[model samples]
Target: MLLTQYLFQADKPLKTTIRNYTEADFNELIDIQKECFPPPFPSDLWWSEDQLGSHIRHFPQGAICAEINGEIAGSITTLIITYKGQDHTWEEITDNGSIVTHDPHGNALYVVDISVRPKYRKTGLGKLLMQSLYHLVVELKLESVLGGSRMPGYERVKDKLTPEHYVESILNGERKDPVVTFLMKAGRTPVKLLPDYLDDPESANYGLLMEWKNPFFEKTK
Candidate 1:
């Protein structure tokens, strides 16, 4: 199944709240990673307690979560970075998911992961999470938000299309990829193609670099 495919229905309107993740949300986050990304996606890549600890320790505000009826249902992890204006793998920029390199004064908010419990997919919760991050960008006076997006739909078409053409097709509205399309809907624009960005076979080991610029940002002299 494609990532972000909504497969379950809730019995009632979800009472949701978005807030920065706390240390208490750690185990739920691990379960979320498993629900969002199952086997074939390496278990080792799941958010580790140490890495999650680093996020709260180094950049607490960048670690956001969504709660449904007081249950942690989704999360979006990020870090402040002095962007180099060049291509970098997820592992490189995210410091192998440890985010130990978080820069308190960096001008960019780099998203490391966005995981929604499988049941909450397509519930508008993802958009809420993204909007929270955008608000952070404005509040922090950051220039933009950046992240490498997984192209989970690539594997199906890789035999007949190059990654570039596949992505272009999605951008042109000729095709729709669940993950890429969701990110685009969340206001991110594709910037570059990152080869060997991860180990996911579904993405063909490729990631799309995406950005959302803050309109309120003022250039520092």
Candidate 2:
């Protein structure tokens, strides 16, 4: 499915399109990650070209990109996995980008990564990317969508509070965390707090375990 939206640039509406990922978008995907995420995190945490290609080949529908005037501005990569009934560390699921655990017939769609280029942020591209994934969840009859949300603003108050407290403050509106706030506003609920989730200092080495349940989920016994 193709989705189109308008993003304003100097009071002029620029056409933005959301479409499935293609093999040609590999380099731009890496470039966008560099632009959106801080150093080391992009290089240290992102999937390698071979891993990304493997994921796309396995679950093409879960990979998507947003473009404006032929430029790739944002992207979302996802995979399917059975729900692990306990708290999970990032390494346990992603396997350090090997993605060896991606289950094609799993019930939940896991958002491996989602990012928007710095210049295109706040132009609604991020929301569009997520919405595309949500629609995919519905189409595939999945139970929910899951992912870790980085608390980019956590470092500002890390010395004064724990990761849990920081998340609580943001949920209650006492603080505004860039990533958590955006995910919450987009209808994802914070289910748990992940400590040492990644190497990013901005997130205080923490993340929020989040999920968006599919409203149409039905049990088949």
Candidate 3:
């Protein structure tokens, strides 16, 4: 296998900066999410400044955006939800059983969602955005990143309010959906792909659970 690496600065054609999600960033984030996803969660749900509050909102200042030519090219949200890793919502069966864990080191970054504007797809911006998160992940000594995938028609028909084309764009890949690609490049692995994982029981779907590990730890043993 061949590995490729290059020098990169944020001032290229597709430049991006990671910063706090603010009231100003909310509209752009919403637009990007809606553009890239189908059957998008109601804008009202996201309009709130609550950090998934009252719930285990890892709203740990991990949400960020990719600005290309001074515009919002993409946006990403990372939050960790501690679950019974022994079991999952997918069809896969496991015996791990009722295991509970918290941010062992106090700062694991979990990837909730990542999105790229339709026009900016494939310019390697997504990878850059993904790589930026590592600075925080490693700084916090976090364990891994986590998130879910939308089935082709799951979002569209889940609420029966989404347009068919919008759903297809995200599910099937509009301009190379990089969720799977970037995750792999960043040393993350997909542990599951289950059917009907989302709310739409009728929709054929799969969920991807990915992990990003620290290479330093691998060499010590």
Q: Considering summed lDDT, which 10 consecutive residues are worst modelled in model 3? A: 91-100
Local error of candidate 1 at 72, Å? 0.4
A best-first ranking of the candidates according to their TM-score comes to 1, 2, 3
Candidates in order, TM-scores: namely 0.92, 0.91, 0.60
Full-model lDDT for every candidate? 0.87, 0.83, 0.51
Alpha-carbon deviation at 201 in model 1, angstroms: 2.1
The prediction achieving the highest TM-score against the true structure is: 1
Q: Encode model 3's per-residue lDDT on 94-204: one tens digit a residue.
A: 111111222333334555557778777666767766776776666555555554444444433456433333334444555223345556665666555544444433344
Decide which is better by TM-score, 1 or 3. 1
- Mind giving the per-residue lDDT tens digits that candidate 2 earns over 25-95? 98888888778767755476555688778767777888789999999998888888898666676667766
Candidate 1: worst 10 consecutive residues by lDDT? 1-10
Ranked by TM-score, the better of candidates 2 and 3 is 2
Candidate 2 residue pairs in backbone clash: none
For all candidates, what are the clash counts? 0, 0, 0
